[model samples]
Target chain A: MKKVLGVTLGILTAIGGFVDIGDLVTNALVGARFGLHLAWVVIVGVIGICLYAEMCGRVVAMSGRPVFDLIRERLGPRTGLLTLVASFLVTLLTLIAEIGGVALALELASGVHYLLWMPLAAFAVWLVIWRVKFSRLEQVFGLLGLLLVVFAVALFTLGPDWGQLLHQATRPHPIGHENWATYAYYGIALFGAAMTPYEVFFFSSGGVEEKWTRSDLVTARSNVFVGFPLGGLLSLAIMGGAAVLFLPAGIKVETLGQVTLPVAVALGKLGLAIVLIGVFAATFGAALETALSCGYTIAQYRGWQWGKFVRPREASRFHVVIIVCLVLAMLTLLTAVDPVQVTEYSVVFAAMALPLTYLPILIVANDPDYVGEEKNGPVRNAFGLVYLALLTVASAAAIPLMIITKGGQ
Target chain B: MPGESGRVLHAQLHLLDRQLIDQADGHLAGKVDDVELDLDADPPVVTALITGRERITARRIVDITTAVTVSVEDLDLDYYDDWVENHVIAKIPGARHAPE
Candidate 1:
């Protein structure tokens, strides 16, 4: 029974932990504009992340080393340093976006401007990281984040034409005066939102923090296989809600208010309140993950002692890094930039940095010395290689598409 | 150890940039940022592990499996760790204790 409970908890946290500000904004934005025409990208992205995250868990479980450690070891210092800088910048940008997201959620709840709430949200994030146990921190945010499942509830309550939604999902294309460039740009953004690189860094390091061993692989696999797909379903529901409400009405999802409006229309003020809390939990959870990921990547690269499993004094450098990152994020958000815009750019840049993060993981996962008998098999390698190719294409095209579409207009 | 075991290990592949684990507490110390080589020897041997740009003699090495295990007194390779701890994190109220 304890074992079953552990597996269930892992799956629940994984599902809840999956969505973030990027997923929230991008899905609603895409749905508002393109309907479900780009739903196939989400499926492809879910599979990719599951495959990548599974390999990351396996590596950490077997080798007891997190992803960045292996990244430096496999890629060599010069190339690894380049990857580090790129990944760090992207993660930091994501940190800023998440902080902004938390403030926005607060603003939606309290009616104060989001900018007024930025520092408080950031400080709360830092305090949690400083004082909370790793397990407690993860479980609290992850479980609360499940409130986002209200998107599905709202969609069902809205009573949309399921057959038409499926038809749009099956046939992929630009919709309603949208060109292929904008469609493709949003497609990459959605993909990046789904398979954000920080997810891997946080997942692997969390495994190591939880002291997962080879015996825990079953729990890990179930989390990835069950939790993530269900999370993807929630993302689809957000899209469906937007598609049902906003697409036909010629409304674009430009703000967090619009993202929550469909739920309000479908399920009333009670639903809006629930969705606001859900958005708060999701964004706040992501803020913690991105903040820690900044420290994890840098410390692991430098081979410094890191992780909340140890006392803050023990991992002083790591804690300091997190502090510095939070300060920077707070400062960035104070510039009065739109958090939604930051979310869009962060995901696009995440798309650009995908290969830098995943390529080394793929290489190390196949290394016999690191994972020993658990090295990648032919089928895993086949999918791994295919994903690598796709990531490379996405990375190469991300910037150009951003420019051509003028940042998705 | 590689020479003793008659195993040919490439520096880039096996040593450089690998993690250095402190065996005493099983905490990470640093990376094998570079290696000190005995160039005068016929086939140059790795004399020490350079971690955080500081050379720790190979005699402190406890084992070399996937990671280089080193027996060191402080495992804080450089002053940076201490500086950060003392000046920043340790100044915080709950720095010394692990979260309950």
Candidate 2:
């Protein structure tokens, strides 16, 4: 019973950890603009993330090495350095976007400009990464992020025609003469949001920090299988709300507040307050994850000591990287660049870097040299390979689709 | 430094760049940056694994005499010396007991 409960909690944390600013913004925006037509992309993205995350988690549990460590071993120094540069840039971009996202969520609640809160947000994110224990960080933010159930609650409160919602989700069509390029562009964005590389990095590294062993493979599997899909469900609820409330009114979701407007409209002030808390927890948690992910990727690649389990002064370089990445992200946000636009752009680039980050995990996981008796089973290998192919397509098309659709117009 | 039993069999495949693991608690030591091959044999054999950062930098890079050379060459060599323990890393501060 205790084992079951622990596994269940791990799964729940994964679900909450999965949804970040990208999914909240992209899913709602796409659902509002293109209706449920791009819903298929979310499903694809979730499957890809689950498969790769599971492989990476398994690899960590078995080998006690994180994905980036294996990436260095597999790619050698020069290519690994290249991977580190590209990945760090993309992860830094994501960190900046998430920092801006947390501030925006705070802004929605307090009515201050998000730009004013950016520095504080970045500092708090770094402090938490520096001091908070891995499990404590995940638990506090993960469970609190469950407040996003307001979207699910709002769906019931709005009492939408389920038949229509289901029908639209099943039969995806671009709404009202939108071109397929625009549709495909949003599809890539949604896909990118679901499969962001940092999640896998954070997940595998977190497994290592938590000291997950081969026996804990059950815990890891439970987390990826249950947590991610349920997290994806929250995204779907947000999309559903936007589709029901915003689409009918010809609205396009451009702001974080706009994404929560449906809950406010459907469930009033109480729902809006809950939605704000949920967004705060979600984005704040993601900010921590991505910031630490930046530190983890760099330190792991270079074989430096990292993790909050160690004292701050002991892992100076790791903490230094986190601080530097956070400052850079905050500085980027201070440029008054639209945070939402930055998020949209980050997710698309996440799509482009997907293969670089995940393919290493897939290769390492299947290596008997790494996992010994626990390499991927045939079925898992087939699933991973097919998803790898899909990721390649998504990655190949992400930039071109962005250019063609002018960042989804 | 080569013992009768511990000579380099294949430097690239077996020793160089492989992760050094402490035998006692399995905490990571460091990567085998480069090896010192003893010339006192019929053929050269690896004698000691050089695992420090300064040693690695000097061995890996070609031009160590550039404008940036002073900082790398001079900055407190003591810090790099104690970082990667020779042979095993079981003596590191946190490696003994299971982390609480």
Candidate 3:
């Protein structure tokens, strides 16, 4: 019974911890504009993340080293340093977006404007990282984030035509008057949202924080396999709800509020209240993850002691990096940039940065020195190489697509 | 180093940029940023691990496998770490306490 509960808890957290501002905004916007036509991208992304995250977890379990550590060892100093700078900038951009996301969610709940909430939200995120135990912090937000299941419930309540939705998903083309270029652009954005690079960084570092060993491989695999796919289902549910409520009415999701409207329309005020809390928990949780990932990437590359397992004074450089990142993110949010715009660009840039992060993980995972007898089998390598090819195409095309579509105008 | 003195190892493949773990407290000290090599030896051999972009010799190295484990009395490689801990991080309230 205890073992079942433990496994259940891990799965629930993975589901809740998966979605962030990028997933929420991109899925809703794409759904409203393209119906379910781009849903296949989300499916592809989920599989990609599950594959790489499993490798990252396995490496950490076997070697007691985080992803960035392996990145440096495998990529060497010059190329590794370049990758670090690029990955760090992208992760920092993600951190800024998440901070803005928490503030936006706060504004949705309080009606006080997101700018006023930015500093408070960032401070609270830092405080939790500074003062809370790692497991406790993860569990609290992960459980609360489950409230986003309201989207799935609301979609069923709306009673959309299941056959039509299935047709759109299968067809995978631009809907309405939208052209192929914009459709492909949005598809890449959805893919990027689902497989953001920071997720792997946070996952491997969190594994180390929890002290995962070879014996924990089964638990890690279960979390990646069971947890992430279910989380993707929730993303699809959000997209489907938007397609049902916003597509026919020609409503585009320009704000976080629009993402919640389907629930409010279907489930009324109680559902609105629940979904707001869900958004808050999910965005806030991601804020914590991205902030720590900024610290994790730098600290691991430089070989500074890191993780919430240590006292702040002990991991002083790591803690300092987190503080600095928060301050910068909060300041960027204060400039009144649209959090939604930040979310869009961050995910696209995340797609561009994907190869830099994952290629090294794939290389290191196959190295016997790191994983010993647990090195990648032929099947894993097959999928890994295929995804590597796909990711490279996405990375090369991300900027050109964004430009051609005028950032998906 | 714990390996046999005559053991053959490739410097770039085996040593460069590997993580340096302080075995005493099991904390990460730094990375092998560069290596000091004895060129007079027939094929040359690494004499010390350079860390923190400085030329400090990692004289206390205990093992050299995937990661290099060293037993240093003081992790002087982390000058920035000490300065930040004392002047910045320690000044914050509850800095000395681990999260509950």
Q: What share of the reference contacts is kept in model 2?
A: 0.03
Docking class of 1: high
Ten contiguous residues with the weakest lDDT in model 1 chain A: A330-339
- Backbone Cα, N, C clashes tallied per candidate: 0, 1, 0
Model 3 Cα shift for residue B2 (angstroms): 5.5
lDDT value, residue B41 of candidate 2 = 71
TM-score of chain B taken alone, every candidate = 0.80, 0.46, 0.80
lDDT tens digits, residues A1-409, model 3? 8867877898999999999999999999999999999999999999999999999999999988899998898898788888899889888999998889888888988999899889999999999999999999988999899999999999999999999999999997897889998998888898889999899999999999999999889888988999999999999999999999999999889999999999999999999999999999999999999999999999999889899998999999999999999999988888888989999999998888888889999998899888999999999999999999998999999999999999999
Give TM-scores for every candidate, taking all chains together and pairing residue i with residue i. 0.98, 0.87, 0.98
Clashing pairs in 2: A15-A227
Q: What do the candidate models score in CA lDDT, each in turn?
A: 0.91, 0.77, 0.90
Candidate 1's displacement at residue A235, Å, is: 0.6
1 against 2, candidate with superior DockQ: 1
For model 3 the local lDDT of residue B62 reads 77
Q: What digit string (tens of lDDT, one per residue) describes model 1 on residues B1-100?
A: 3456544668778888888887788888888988888889877777888876577886777787778898887545747887988888888999988787
DockQ of each: 0.84, 0.09, 0.81
Candidate topping DockQ: 1
TM-score of chain B of 3: 0.80
